[model samples]
Target: MSAEPPVSLRELRARAEEVVTPEAWEYLETGAGAEVSLGEAESAWQRWRFRPYVLRDVAQISTSCRLLGHDLATPVLVAPTAYHEPYHPTAELGTAEGVRDAGSLLCLSTRSSRTVERVAEYAGPWWLQVYVMTDRDITEAMVDRAVAAGASALVLTGDTPYVSRRARGTALPLQDEVALVNVQQHLAGRTWSSLEQDPRVTYADIEWLASRSGLPVLVKGVLRADEARACVAAGAAGVVVSNHGARQLDRVVPTALALPEVARAVADQVPVLVDGGIRSGHDVATALALGADAVLVGRPTMHALATGGAPGVTAMLRALTAQLAEAMGLLGISSLGGFDRSLVEDVTHARG
Candidate 1:
């Protein structure tokens, strides 16, 4: 029999933990070093107090928006997380279908177990998240394949030169468990160690990737205003203010805290997005108020997929969108454009 659907994100994670193996659970939950950044990232959103307007017409609310020329039913997008196969039998296909059904979008990871072509068959509007490897050919080939397979854009992960030392170690044997179907043939008898992310990657590489693939590239893992500005100068089509989900570094600034500065740096030259610790529609509104064009949810998507596969993911996306619409109505804002810095204020100190 299928498992019961989750009623809350916390419950959803609890159910997923019950089914996922101990090692996989640790791999999924733990962060680098002391995990300080990981723990703080989630709570950072709560510091923002919404300044809602009253007496405004809220009879019609629309959460619809466009990103990089693609229309979305909601401002929420599925952030790229690797190896969905371990979470469900359907894996990325399940995620693709769920996001498509919800009229949202998916960002497929480079380390995905599913091939780009296969996912494209099941996905709606999608983008490819890339990790430039030691073997640049492998990265380029995959990007070319994804472009051919219908990827609308490329999201280049700027953090993570190498995987950080997580607080908890796991014995999941990722070499065997991960199919890496997208670039397996390109392995060319090379050692797995040889394929580690190239630490030498720089701003110039960002321009190269976009020019080579003929697709707009959004640099992810940015936290500073200067870095965001550099990315735009280097021809990045967008900027994602993320701390690599707080997995790459310990004690780093949270995306919520970093977003406004990064957004201001770009000056709307490109779309700015924020992820990490986004839990509800209120947080979505908070992010937009802080200058994000949209928000991305990572772990919750995995939790939902693990519990009930495609339906679970679809339900989760729909629930969040519904909450966002409700939040818009309650805030007396009728559209996505209504969100601004004026809508939120930092209440970290005056909470009393």
Candidate 2:
């Protein structure tokens, strides 16, 4: 646990550094190739300075938000991540508990150490994030399992259609501890010779998974405006414009830059959310004001958890939630509906 009192996410991140492996730390911290985009994501967040308006009655404040029919205490959802056990033995379950207790949503990853069914046993207003495999059977089966396990939402990641080529720290060895349970049965007869055939995404993958899931399915990893339109037309309830946190492709536009176009393209056809370098509650406010219905967060939470475990994650959320409320109160936003395009003025020559 962190000896220092955590007043905000920054404190949680500093504490997380003490417990995380150097290799895993780099894995979470690094961006694609030369890491220019990674820096840009940070720069993007920093560039968007807030215009605060004081002298309002903020006696009553609410951070409540709804995604796919589930109301969140805060719009902050736990972005999908794999193998929490590496950071804490309780792994994704601990993450679920944190999200549940925090009154936010936990989106369990397809690659999670805990099976979807097992993770579902924890209290949730949760979503299951799935990787669409080339094999229709596997995709269909994963959807079936997620549905049976009582998952309320399905997030299909479209960004990571292939393995990432970026350079990062050494991959933490999860072979001995973490196993992918949902696809394990289908992988039994799969051989190295057939490995090329095992990618978890295909046209049939989308069509098949949607056929089985009665819940809302969100397509993640979208960047281009045309692709955003396609995802909605293909029946996505929402789109999460992301470049896999700059982990997949280097030099891609920062997640925030790509969001406005995609959000415009979708045009209420579906809600749009984005993720890449979001770090704070003001970042969340800025994202909403620009166009996103919500935003996703990844590495920061892990950074916090790696530093402080449950308390670290708890403190991080508490600070972000408080900061978000403060941002809103300062912005004179009595509710989310009040945030609009006029609220955000794009800074020229500023990092996007």
Candidate 3:
């Protein structure tokens, strides 16, 4: 018989660290400043306890859900991360294929090593992540190109107006040929620093982008209830409670802790998704119970891509989904519709 593959994310990350260069590994692992936000994002999930129901008909657990009109086989999506080429030769295409195989969604970053069109060719349900450029024309053109290339929605990343300082120091510079394929022609001869996004971008831009592309807009990086509501009012189809995986801001409120307020502010008017330090199925369940309609995973997906290309990503996603289903079964919840605030208790307060 064939040997079993690694089903644990932690195991995959360890194996990936062994294969990738020190620079790449550091870039993937390090967060901004003291890394307190990064650590908190994962640990905060543990502060909540599941209050499982008994004697309910959870014989067949279904992990299906819908996000912005798209049906997802699972509530998880591969969150947009930059420069996949550092992880594997196939880069975003390999990641796309893995997400497709897992029957999940993918959010492709504008900084991807491959063009949006190329990645779209391999993906299933996909969204295009955009960092509004200092150059308005360039930003508009990118949005158009992604929509033309079959992106299902536009995920406007709002938290990274300026790059953060990483506590673990910088990675080695990317090679000249390691271009942002989607916008390389427009950026020829310019340093990556020249691509710095507009720090002053506002809600007006979100409205303009929605009008320009006519695609559903999801404003990522919102932590406050007011900000979440503002995004929706400004034409956001969804709001993602994120702190750029706690990479853009240090000591920010963890996304897990921030999700409840944002979710309540949006109040079902628009889907609320989150991404931070989610690493397991229990994390996924915790997000849902706190009011996240779906969750996006970044580091874990990158770790999987680094280890085994498309197959590793598929295995990682499958493992997460399986764990989620098992958790639902144990909680006596048969479907996502059954998830409610009552299912979770904030043990952090109770402990005090």
The root-mean-square deviation over C-alpha atoms between each candidate and the true structure, in angstroms, is 3.1, 3.5, 2.5
TM-score of every prediction relative to native: 0.95, 0.90, 0.95
Model 2 alpha-carbon drift over 4 Å, by segment: 1-6, 51-57, 192-205, 349-352
Model 1 lDDT per residue over 1-352, tens place? 1122324677788999998878777877888789899999879999889879999998888989999999999899999998888788898999999999989999999888789999999999999999999989888999999999999999999988888888885645455536667777788777886578999999998898999899999999999999999999999999998988788789999988999899888947999998998888788889988899988999999988988899989888888888888888888899999987888889975545
Candidate 1 residues lying further than 4 Å off, grouped into runs, are 1-7, 171-177, 349-352
Score residue 11 of candidate 3 by CA lDDT: 81
Q: Which digits, one per residue and each the tens of the lDDT, describe model 3 over residues 214-278?
A: 99999989999999989988889999988887787798998888999998899589999999878
- lDDT, residue 22, candidate 3: 89
TM-score of 3: 0.95
Query: What are the lDDT figures for the candidates, one per model?
Result: 0.87, 0.74, 0.86
How much lDDT does candidate 1 score?
Answer: 0.87
Kindly indicate the candidate among 1 and 2 with the higher TM-score. 1
Give the higher-TM-score candidate: 2 or 3: 3
